[model samples]
Target: MIAVFDRVLIANRGEIAVRIIRTLDRLGVESVAVFSDADADAPHVRAATTAVRIGPADARRSYLDGAAVIGAALAAGAQAVHPGYGFLSENAAFARACAEAGLVFVGPPAPAIETMGDKIRARAAVEARGVATVPGIARPGLSDADLVEGAAEVGYPVLVKPSAGGGGKGMHRVDRADDLPAALAQARREAAAAFGDDALFVERFVAEPRHIEVQVLADAHGAVIHLGERECSLQRRHQKIVEEAPSPLLDPAQRAAIGRAACETARAVGYAGVGTVEFIVSARRPDEPFFMEMNTRLQVEHAVTELVTGIDLVEQQLRVAAGEPLALTQDGIRLAGHAIEARVYAEDPSNGFLPTGGRLLDVRWPADVRVDAGVAAGSLVGAHYDPMIAKVVAHGATRADALASLQQALSATRLPGVTTNIRFLGRLLDLPAVVAGDLDTGLVDREVPALSADPVPDADFAACAVHEVPSGHGAWRADGWRLAGARGAVLRYADGDGEAVVTVRERDVVVERAGSRAVVPRAELADLEVRAAEDGATLWVSGAAGDRAISRPALVRRALRASSPELVSPMPGSVVAVHVADGDEVALGDAVASVEAMKMEHVLRAPVAGVVRLLAVVGAAVVRGQRLAVVEPPTDERRP
Candidate 1:
């Protein structure tokens, strides 16, 4: 057995890197962080004891470059390397490169990675061990006739997936025989783009399946221990949104059976280190759980497992890499509490969940819960990487308490300038079906309209206005005045819906047609202290909603400016195709340009008809609502 390394290099970024660093520090091991140009100022880079500049923000040159990562590890004096998920985590070549460099790769061996990385081979391996897998095809060179025969054997509504891909990439669902060819081609294209593997396979799509995964830890001694299960039923477009521990759907017997199967599958591969066995649990048949795919490295939702079992998975990985034996037996493990995690992404939930990029003006997380974030307030949410900003996790003695905590944490979060899934998460937590543990992969799609609806109440806007008034000028003082006897500066603000007008007179914020008054207490008013300027009153408001700085005069002007003519650019991407000619007549939702970003294609549509005026052309980069085009209405129509 090799000696334990004194230093380890983290070859990734975001919350996972930070998480690894924390564990390394606790283990008395030095940590090295490698970052691209875009992530130089990231929190994970700053938290590392040593940092290395890998390359540009493009993942291909930095994170995915195994040679560069190995060089960085050697240069930083790291004797081991930890690939924190995504990027090169599952790349067999990366693990082999690390092994060749005499650096202990903190994961399974290269051969193990190769075996489990391929969906077809992994399925075959699991099946050989008598583990039940989804009915599917694993062989290659199948023609349209072969595909039809295979679908008939596997049954209808089969899912076509890339043989060498995960993370929902290169996956297509075919409900009928007519759509099989198109689905196969699309899945192959996506697979080639994502994993450089166009090999495809077919599987029976488990209708309304609960995405459950079992965490397994294995050591060099050939012992594998399954760490219960995680319920990841809440998903959007095959991507997990909310993950919880101690699946509410599983009874003790079912949990034990699934866990045993997962352990047997791990042993079949002679697995080591931390890995996850993902399963698709059928709603119609809870007694059967089909093996999906095994994540060879740590999972993004590992924190839920950590919260429930009180075990730091990264630490376990480190230990297992150091050739240590399993510390605890299966009998000794106990899941104490329920835990839930919500991934806060920099995306607009109302706008097709398109990624948002901007400078973070503010970020305030709940103090009661654990918030693992990789960006700060001033950090830039760029198109260079994943749109996820942070993962917020809450643990409680019961699922209800955990749900409540998650809801409270989401509500307490204060983020401005960039759109987030915070409000959507808040609505989701309060969902009756969710509260009752009745969840499915289609929950988001089914209740999207309700989930995406604006949740800020009218009272919130009124409170925001009153909370915007300058402290010394509010009603807290007998003769409220910033300047002696100066009548509280007339403050005009807009309510939540922007329909009602709010006027602050003599330190009292009056909401039109609303009878209730929110008095600014002297103590609370101090917290809302503001500086009076010639143009406006800049006030700071602190409350359960988190802190905010509001400019009284600017708010009124913004409220009025909201009605101005505006053009919104749909999707986050660079304009790839522009067809509009100035003065050309166009109808509503006309295609202006094709915006390509995040490897997804989106066609920018015009909002109205008139004479089309284009501001951006092909190859020009644009952000959300950056005014890419303008409609002049019709020549006969008069401007209001």
Candidate 2:
């Protein structure tokens, strides 16, 4: 038996760090954690045996700074470093640095990371190893003209993907030849912003494609084994939301074939430690699976793989890093039961899945299944990091049972302040296609409207009223109670554009919205969970109807900005670029500036055709609804 390191520094943060710490503690090893100013009070910081400050909140200065991380490891007297995915997990330079420092890096070699890190190179390398890759045009440097010409030959409906990043950050789909040029420009900008490499490749968009990935572990002694597969087709904008093990779409023979291909791909680069090989399988033809790219580190969905295989992947990484050989052979591995995981993000499904952030007022995790969370009550959910707050993983004897268990777990989850996709995930699982295991990449995007059509029920408004009113205030407080000194017994709350007027009577609470009234008894609503924000300006009410966030209406505030022609930032982020100059004439819906947050870019457009007055400067941080630019109507069309 090989001995694990005495001390290891985890070079990442969030749930992954907590997960690695758990394994390190189980094996009696000291786990060192590194955090930035923003993560000083994070859950992962307190979970580690020892912690060190890295840098500031900006990732480039902290998590992405390889030099800072190496310095921290050396100063902490760590024998090794475990990059738990993201940040520098796939950074070849960082891996080489660790090796030079006489520290074991719990991942593949630098050469392997280099080869598999680039999609263009990865596609070529795997294809040389007799692996079937999806037909596409990939190279180091392809100009816009070159890509446009290649797209025509590769046929329309192609995906433009970045050569360097793994997550679907810079990916775009063009269905027609006319739109290929514009898509290429936007893809290049995003690719450069995300990966510092604007190189792109075009591949044919598979109709009804299913994302299947195989987890494999290899040691430095040249032994590799597969740990089955995971289905990750439930996605929005190419980001996976839900994942399950032992894809229901694959039969026994197909699973073996894909598993063999995954091992062969790993062997092509002499990969060591744990790695996941992704494949794109056509839903209509599940037998023919095409090679996608290899993730050189542990995946976010690795929990589902572990649940089915009964293997501690983090422990395997630690052992492999200590120069251990295969503990189990190919034939000895067994895949039992099934597992499903839902990634809970701080995002609003109803608002185009825009990222949301705030102080978490209260967080209650489910008790039944395994939960990997990065935040706790009073934790700050910021815009500087990935919005995924936690993951809920459930295992059962069968696929149906696992699905049901996951749904129940999600319903029991509660995060008061920040908006999450929990309710939407519960609804997505009930969709006919997802329930029957008939999934595709576009399913979530297509069904977004129906899945996000949750409306605030009147009962929730009544619950908020009960929770917000002071004891001596005659049961309810009106909008003008504090401002205008009016002591009315009616409450006025607003959600988005809708308003609700509530009255608390002796035994019943009456709620009126849009000329409809509903009376709910006080005792009947006693079970509703009411969580107030720290400032008491907002109330989150949870009941059988659903979760709702209500706040007192600002009638005067709304009236002042109702007729203002301004283009505002929809989310809190930094202004990356401005397309138009001050006083430049712009048409309606014209792109004015770009704002980036959580690694996603959003373009702000002019609301009316008029001369532009830019108010936002590049590199300035802005908040949600912060005005970025304004359009002044010409004097001929201006209102007197």
What is the lDDT, from 0 to 100, of the residue 478 in candidate 1?
18
Candidate 1, 294-403: lDDT as tens digits: 99999988999999999989988988988899987999899999999999987767657887776666667788888888888778778767777789999999999999
TM-score of each: 0.81, 0.96
lDDT of 2 by residue, 166-223 (tens): 7898898899998888778788888888878888999999989999999999999989
Off by over 4 Å in 1: 1-3, 141-156, 174-186, 459-504, 507-640
Model 2 regions lying over 4 Å from their true place: 1-4, 470-488, 544-547, 554-563
Give Cα distance to truth, residue 155, candidate 2, Å. Answer: 0.7
Candidate 2 global CA lDDT score: 0.87
* TM-score attained by model 2: 0.96
TM-score of predicted structure 1: 0.81
Query: Which residue pairs in candidate 2 have backbone atoms (N, alpha carbon, C) closer than 3 angstroms, thus clashing?
Result: none
